[model samples]
Target: MVDDVADVAELGVLTASAAEWSVAVRRAEVIGRLAQEPRVRIAEADEAATQLGISRRQVYELLKRWRAGSQVASDLLPRRSTGGRGRGRLPEEVEALLLEVIRSRYLTRQRRTVSAVYEEVVRQCRTRGLAVPSRGTLERRIGRLDPVASVTARQGADAARALRSAGGEPPVVEGLLEQVQIDHTVVDLEIVDERYRRPIGRPYVTVAIDVASHCVVGLVVILEPPSALSVGLCLAHMATDKRPWLERLGVEAAWPMSGKPREIFTDNAPEFTSEALQRGCDQDGIKQSYRPPGQPHFGGIIERLIGTMMEMVHELPGTTFSNPAERGGYDSQASAVLTLAELNKWLALAVAVYHGQVHGTLKQTPAGRWEQGVAEGGRPATVSSETAFLVDFLPAERRTLTRTGFTLDHVQYYCDALKPWIARRRQLEKIVLRRDPRDISRVWALDPDGDSYLPVPYRTMSRPPISLWEQRAAVARLRELGRDQVNETALFAMVEQMRQITEDAAARTRRARREVERRSATPVTRRTPQDPAPLPPAAAQDPAEGEPVRPFEVIEQW
Candidate 1:
């Protein structure tokens, strides 16, 4: 029995001490005997305690302790600490000031370094003429401060509330191709230049992720903001490369490419709401769903993909574009392009690996699940590829009317196709042309096929100050021709006549003003008479006088 008890003790059924069981049993017996005694309970209790090898006073004390513990347990009471010590270290006011500094000086400026904050605190102290604390003391103070910790907690609570209000539980993607989320994320990376030996640009990375597969189907990196072009390129890539996977899975390779994803989800970005995108979906018969604004969790799959890209960027050799030798002194544009190229290369490899590997969520690889779906006879939805192409190609633009037919981007294009219709309805003046900003080569005109689009080449007209060289040359030629043909003599004669008439009018006006002034003022008497003009001598009288003098002299000499 001792060996059995030892075995029981080893198994934890009984404790190591054999006396413990005896003590417990004796205590229980004493309590039982005491309960049975109605009158003279004190004497009975004393007899029971003596029989149990415990004192009557000791038994009463043990019962009282046990009852107190039981009451405490039943009440779920908390015991106070031994000391009445207040909170340690920093005062509430100081802690609050620390948190304010953290928010205003640190968080707002994105300066998360503790050392930086320490220096700032010292600077502020010096400016305020307060005693500056040591770095360690400041750190301790910071630790004591909550520092808007509740803000994050409150945000999480609000997100939970928003998720609840969004309605409907999140869909459980069972297999690959079951669901896919498409979205664009801006990636900040320095793209290095091969020729310039410097980083040139930063570009945005638009990605489409398969939720169940965790595969990046398509990715496009462009310098411009996320536009319809970027989105279309991504979709086009998915349609081309993943066609086999889509076909084998009996997924619709039609309009809404990606096999009419059970549901298409994206954020409420303007590009997603563009007419081109909407028309493309209409052509593909794909129903698009938009997530609530500022609620990224609804499209968490793609948002997480963005986070993964950011992580990858962080792990790169240079986190910033400042490294001239390493990342080639790249500007935002160069950085963007290089990052996109690297991202694409990495994405391709990652996607291949992801699709080949068995997914934890789906319990099968994407390729495997796709094959299974195909074998299970999933119907591929029919969509017109032509219609899809048309919708994707169509560009959104505003309509405008111009004098010379229709002007698009300052280029006038007269559509022969639209001419007849305009003439028949006499709506030539009302006919407005809308051109795609992306493809200025094509003007939006009514074509013969009754489609309101006609291809017109893009051209620019010269303005007044900045006329084209050809226009300037033509103007110079016209001026030269006019100069050669014009009569200079007639022009001079006309100018002379005009000058004489102007002088005459000015003299008359001066005389009239003088007369008015003389009549208004006191008149002054003339001091001297004007000299008379000398008379011209008559030739006949002068010759006669000279001849008479000569004849009289000749007669006296004879």
Candidate 2:
């Protein structure tokens, strides 16, 4: 029985302390059963004995003591002698010595182990002519120290601070889409440009996941890093129907989930903390909750979802995998075959697969779980329109309205709506310019009444619809070509010409390198009639020796 008890303790099924609690609860229940049936105490004692697997007399004695007005549970539970650790075994002076040594030497960034501290404690005991406690006693003392202090000693202040809130289990979100998490991670696969096929770089993917259903509601794959624009675009994708977008990519599946989430949980990224995002949330009646700073585990839901998607990406041809060891000798850049557009389509398909496949945690496909949630009366919230979402969530900047029209980043913008404000500066007035980071060809100027935005087009029609990245690249290229200022027509025209030139060059190179085989061609092993006779080594003099030496006469100079 003693060995069995030790084994149980080792297996963590039951401990000495836990067993004592179990006995105390049983004692209380048995006592309560007897008290209600005083006349049938003997019969009750028999039943209780059988149920508890103890002798009947023991139950009787327990009831007798309970009837005598003692705390039955407390008296039954195990207690140390004199309510303390084996009293008088280790001197108080010696315990204090050990604690002081641990606090001063062990509980620090130096990471002094308990064994080292114990050895030092022995030395201190000898110096003080004190009795040395056993090693177990010293270890127990160390274990009893405050957990925060212990972590601080072993790790550092940051880890110790994190430990404060890391102790509890994650909060339970009750309903599907009741809370959603959003985060961004750079996809670990290299991609190339669609036209030039030159290696661009790894693209960032911002994903929003339903916390309850574990469904990936929306994602944006772009060459840009995490930014407010990406966050807003991700939210727009979440709140709007995705079927059209998926269909554009030739993805044949159903993405029936889309709605404005009630609450959004995010980390302390600047994009999440940006003023535009906060204002949009407030305007849309969505509550935004930021995870505590320095505690990334709080946003584990979205992070894990991103990780899951990246794992799927790893199966592709040019994946970077997760680490150098996993990648080994794989040439990610040279092996890259997918362009950004192709990658986006693949991501859409992967998301479809993710939704269809059963999740280990949800025990159901995310799509199935989402359908179930909707069937059980879970309705998704939605925005007015995609245009409204973009206008509301896009970042805003301040610029002064001028007669030449509002210029931003060295580009001028004008529209019929801006005619009234031209050369007329309202008192203390600055036009609020809202530009979409994805598209810089246009911007919206807020009306003075703040009722609507006035669309402002680029000053030149030659500047076709282009993204911020393209615009920047064009400007950089012009600068490289020694241009001090950008001529809108000339700059954009040059960009288009360069793109055309590259495409034509690639086409020509491919065409010129094409191999052609003629049906009449044959090997000369049998000396075909059309084949010329091989020249002798001496007769085939090097071309540089001018073997056929034409006669020439030197002209006399006057």
lDDT by residue (tens digit), candidate 1, 302-326: 8767776666675554355324465
lDDT of 1: 0.47
Candidate 2 pairs with clashing backbones: 108-153, 260-381
lDDT of 2 by residue, 384-499 (tens): 34554656677888899887778887678876556566646665388778777655666767777544565576776446655555567678888899989787766677657655
- As for model 2, its CA RMSD to the true structure in angstroms is 22.4
TM values, all candidates:
0.43, 0.66
| Residue 407 CA displacement from its true place in model 1, Å | 1.6
- Cα-based lDDT for every prediction: 0.47, 0.68
lDDT value, residue 508 of candidate 1 = 44
Worst 10 residues of 1 by lDDT: 549-558
TM-score for candidate 1, residues paired by index: 0.43
